[model samples]
Target chain A: MNWKRYERASDLNGALTLLDRAEGTGRVIAGGTDLVLQLGQRQKSAELLVDVTGIDELRGLCASGAWIRIGAAVTHREAAASGLLREEAAVLAEGCGMVGSPQIRNIATLMGNVITAQPAADAAVPLTALGAELRVVSAAGERWVPLEEAYRGVGESAIDATREVATEIRFRRPGAGAKTRFFRLARRKALALPVLNGAVCLWRDGDAGRIREARIALGPVAARPFRARQAEACLTSDRITAALLEEAARLAAGEATPRTSLIRGSEEYRRAMIRLYLTRTLWEMLDIG
Target chain B: MDHGVKIRMKVNGQWREAETTPDRLLIDLLREEFGFTGTKKGCGEGECGACTVILNGRPLLACLIPAAKAEGADILTVEGLTPEQGLHPIQQAFQDEGAVQCGYCTPGMVMTAKALIDENPSPTEAEIKRAISGNICRCTGYTKIVAAIVRGAALLRGEAATTPAGVDRERVPQLPPVGPG
Candidate 1:
């Protein structure tokens, strides 16, 4: 009912020790944008909070090697401004920039979004499209999990991030001519949660520029962020064309299992918008915008 | 509900400490404990930027932030904007450009604008809009508020004060188009 202790973890060991001890009674405060609200609303019954914002290893966004490693604690604002993310991962950078606002983005982390496991989380949608891998760590040691396996349900996760820290999310930079885009349809332009959102990424190859591989992710249309495998398959046969985009849109919407909600929209509208936005996202990627 | 966390931080150039429950919000810490109340608490949730503050050089919502997170960080609020001589350029520009109406959102607006101008000496109109999109002001309809921030940038740059900086009348470049949500 009340947080009995607020322990500041200066490093990863200190954080692991405290978390390992608190067990289920502790909540980790990375950006504190979500946890602080949850704590006040009594949504999380943590008697102790282990602040991991100070952990050195849990910070930084580096693109040095094969993969671009984004620290779990890196705030959305930081990601939006980073030259590396802007270049190699502009979809993620733009998505992060769209989250809540400049104020909220200044403190919300990519890992928090990934771990929130929400269907339409701005950061998670792009990370899912990029096939990002999450390094979930605890005192028990380390394990890497694909972003998909981390989700248990909406706002729920199979990974015990309370017991384990999400150290980083990493992915290889897309190759040349590869297109990545994240698009969302919200009620208002600013500070509105997505009514529906999706991200698309495709690898371009051959002199004719055929789509060699593709990944498509859409949210709030399923329990977790739904990957449109059938839609992605629509692109595999040939280079992009009007017919291909139409087929992909149709398949992507058909792949969705959206629930009818009074706030978001009807199930029919969601499916229709998915088709529309999917086309625009593809058009934008092809520079036909 | 009594025994609490002992926390310390520098707020508006003053090093201060406060004892509170682990669930204490940073907005309360500044207003109640530190007594620098220029920052307003509009929404306890992160939805409203009325509770914005600069922590360690980044603007974050104080209401959504726990007090413990302020430890060892340099925080800037509207109270710290004055340097003994006169009002901060931002406050001055806001007044000159008629940015304030109801005045409830002024402090938070000033802080957010301060962060924007500090980071970008002269942001384009679109950049200015993106910077303050987090903060909401109902009274000014945002035109004067945007104009004031542009003027503030000019004042900070020691440029010609005749016209507001960054094209105040210019329509901001459109952001990425959205779909029906």
Candidate 2:
């Protein structure tokens, strides 16, 4: 709410320069669903808001080479409605669709969701599980940061947003036998944050065959969305039995470090949910019990 | 420092400009500056869809958007839906279906429907539910509201709508303007 001026960047270079000039006092305004809310709460302040909606480069969903690219400016609505994502990475599409409301999804950007780095941020759950990478750009240069290592804690990111902008979000386009699932339970069907959310990506050898690779990510279970490394290690074999799922769920439950929140849920409840959701997601994706 | 920033946008269909503060939200700008009080503010945290307005062809929560960032954008509020030709089809349908209880959430609901019906003239019942999921109505349940939207979609496609058996559709009451010129 303390912004001194507003400027719409005509292009990426102009946006970087404005951010560079504002030093730490500038905030990039994308969909403004998140940025504006933070500003309204006075949780975040700025001297300048470099509206990046004008930049053509930071928009749209595209598949390049081996990765599917999502521009920073791509809204939740756009991501949810994307036919390409629905076909290739339907989990991401489903995740984005479950954001807030039609109004929120229409303006809230996926990049904003990822940058906010909320442990339970819906978009980040799938991005982390699917091994998404962010393309960070600044006046200095550009770099690629994996979604897993990008954050240090809730609302904290290794990437300095004031100095750099998230230009794109991309992940590998999974091939045959690969499936991903995202599951979350909120108080209501809409307009409520997930009490606990989980996303899993796994691949089988063939139709009704052995497991190849697996990745699991849980949110609000820690300072940031985390990879259930031990659980994933359990899933890296052809023998994916119900016992294996049980073991992996137990591991994931141990992986979470949830807290007692008045709004969310208790640490014990969160742990139980991590196990249940992990079991359900694995069975649902693999078409088992 | 001067917080006044220039914003040029198309409201309804006409181009307009306003010098507002960087912190001035679209809901405030529309209600205070332009007198578009039809847009209400509820649950300012973007949970309730009462502040919804179409910005650049998408329904957005105005309370969460700064007016200065809306520059060059084409916005449509509930007022824009009304033409010299009378109430917009959706508004008429809402009235016909008795969808207005408190009338607080009507404007935002109608704008959200406009956004959906414009893109998909024949939206499925499921799609309609998904599209309006952001809007919350405390009275009359959402059944009538959803039906009104379905009928509104039909009306937009120029189809004749017959009142369901035992259902009486009312017209907007003709009342004189109250107070202030």
Candidate 3:
């Protein structure tokens, strides 16, 4: 790659100005794990590299009222190490930890992963399950979108390229008795991208032990990370049982829309593994493990 | 139209100033400009662990970091493991357990292991596996490497000035000299 001008933005306003004045010739880089690869491959262009790692406002995780807010530039490693995130949004933390190896996780940001918009992205599944919302800012103004609605197409998002940048991700705090689990089946154990994955979040209702609500999200089974609404509906207001779990698993597998890849698995095989994970996750969540 | 940037970074415990293209990768800067060849480059795409190094106490892929953005950051490479007296305990353990074969991946492995020990002094086998999961050693099969790290942890704990130290560096295995005497 050829040399390019580099500008380090110390604050959000400064970054906005740089973005505005670059005449659509600049690209914002946070952590640079993904962008560097894209640049090396000549997959993207940016005459002016706006380094955003210096902005302190985009760097922490906190809870406000009933919602947990995470800065866009916060790294996967940071999220994995957070006590508050692990306590409030266990599934999201676990999913972030599984995104890449420790080194990649140390630098790759949560917002960067979402903005990449790959259907098989590990973090998006959990965020979809949590009903996460995003806060996007621009040189012009700001806007908020429910995380699920942010996906306008495959490899495209609702954020405008000319002015907007992801700023925050917010989601409701899970209740005290709630439990979250993330499951995936890939060719190898570590560092390999997910071919298929799922996240499950369930909360119990009082001592009756009935499932008050369940959110099940699957990745690589659709154009975007999708909720298994049929599976969740089967669990609602019902006592945890093996037959119900099996029915839900079958429904989830039937709901998926996996595409054939050049790798080891076929579309049929991917759907089967999705069924296996869904059943096992439900059983484990009910403490039948 | 672009120009090289003059960025100053603290690499291997020393401040270094270099004029690099804006797109220069930190991995190349470490090996080429700083002459710290201990941080290896493998799968420049960051999928491989050969480029692992410690930046500000956190382990990261050097290949994934832009040279210009690393300004004023503390970077520790495998060359920093040994000063003047002797080899680091982790290096010693790898030698005694025969964890190194081709040697191309040793520097990154050692640095990754160092970060793990810094965080968890007495890590279990599972913890050790998790710590080095980012590092791929296709040659040693990871058995000897994991054992070496466990032994190394004990050695590091012993070297501490505290009375209840966890590692004893004196008893660690001895390895050959590392990174240009």
Candidate 4:
């Protein structure tokens, strides 16, 4: 609890002005699920906390044409309950639904999950697969940073929270031919961190029955959310087949770099599970037995 | 800069005000400042739901929320459950089902159940389990807690209460009346 001042920002400009006034010692606090705990544990320090939850511009989930925008204050519970996300971005909804318990979900925002930048963050893994972009606002101006580029390393975010506010996360809605799936392997069903989590967004050609485009995102297997580009390349423009799926799974398993840890288990096990989970996710997406 | 900030919020249907530090947790403000001790502090972190409270119609971990965040928000704690005369239906259901053992997790469990039942009047067994998943009960093993929630739902729906197979309805112990602390 190193905080010396806390101010609630009623709008985006107010937030930026507060941050600019604090210089580099201020940090944005939304949901506070991670930041509060980190501050309590003395893992992080902040001289001022700019509360962004009060800002009206940073609220709700909405759709505009092909893009869906989720404001930074949108909690996991709200996202999970959203009819739009469930129908169009089912993988993101599923990933968010698996985060923590009901209490945690009710207040833990999706942007907070992304900003915390945990490698295996449930929400971030699916957002990565969905190719979401972050709208970051600072005193200079606003910029959209691709979700992949937003991560600096494990537990590190390229967006400086002290000087910037991640306003929203936006991604194009999955088209009619597209389907997505997310799978998480954890110690327990609730209130447990993921040992390994994965998400896949795939589009199939209607007439040709070929894979149109695919994005495979897996986590706790690399420094940040790891995209299996090689694995995705094997499926793109290829006709659907069990053999091809297996080959892609093998490539994905080879691409992962999971570390052996006390909680998540050995690297050998996670690598094997990656192959199995990726295969199952693709199979479920394609309705393959 | 470390001086206390004045914050006003509605707690348990009454408006209350408190001056708190920037880093003071909501749980501390409720228990220490306002004397709403029913909200227990279990893990102090968000891992345990012993400090669960309803904020703006959502059940959230009070320990994780800063006191300043509760400004102008509505909060409901376990102490707010009872009515004018007797125990709340949920509390009565817990008593009938013997849901209280160590009683440490009861406040959180009850608050979580209240939020769930308020949203979904007829929650299934799985829903009840999921609703109270964050609340850790070491004594009851959650079997009675789940049963109590189901029974509480039934009672809330104005249905007649049926006695559990083994428990004697006449011998059920009475809970002390709850009021503003």
DockQ of 2: 0.66
The TM-score, computed over Cα atoms with residue i paired to residue i, of candidate 4 is: 0.95
Residues A1-289, model 3: lDDT tens digits: 5438777889888888988998788878887787788777777678878877678988878998988888877998888889997887889889998988998898898887787777777888899999898888887788888878888777776665435668788889997878898888777888887888889999888644899898999988888888999989988865677888888889988887887778737888888888888998889888753
> Taking the true A–B contacts (Cα pairs closer than 8 Å), what share appears in each candidate?
0.84, 0.87, 0.85, 0.85
lDDT of 2 at B178: 94
Q: Model 3, stretches more than 4 Å misplaced? A: B159-181
Error of 4 at A152 (Å): 1.3
TM-score of chain A of each: 0.95, 0.96, 0.94, 0.97
Model 2 spans > 4 angstroms off: B1-3, B162-181
> Per-residue lDDT for A49-133 in model 2, tens only?
8888778998869999888999988988899889988888877888898888878888789998988878888888988988999
Q: Which ten residues in a row have the lowest lDDT in candidate 2 chain B?
A: B163-172
User: If both were scored by TM-score, which would come out higher, candidate 1 or candidate 3?
Assistant: 1
> Which candidate, 3 or 4, would have the higher TM-score against the true structure?
4
Query: Could you report the DockQ of all the candidates, in the order they appear?
Result: 0.54, 0.66, 0.62, 0.68
Candidate 1 Cα misplacement greater than 4 A, ranges:
A287-289, B164-181
* Candidate RMSDs in order: 7.6, 3.8, 4.9, 4.3
Which regions of candidate 4 deviate over 4 angstroms?
B162-166, B169-181
User: How close to the true structure is residue B69 of candidate 4, measured as C-alpha lDDT?
Assistant: 80
Highest DockQ against the true fold, candidate: 4
In angstroms, give how far residue A140 of model 2 lies from its true place: 2.9
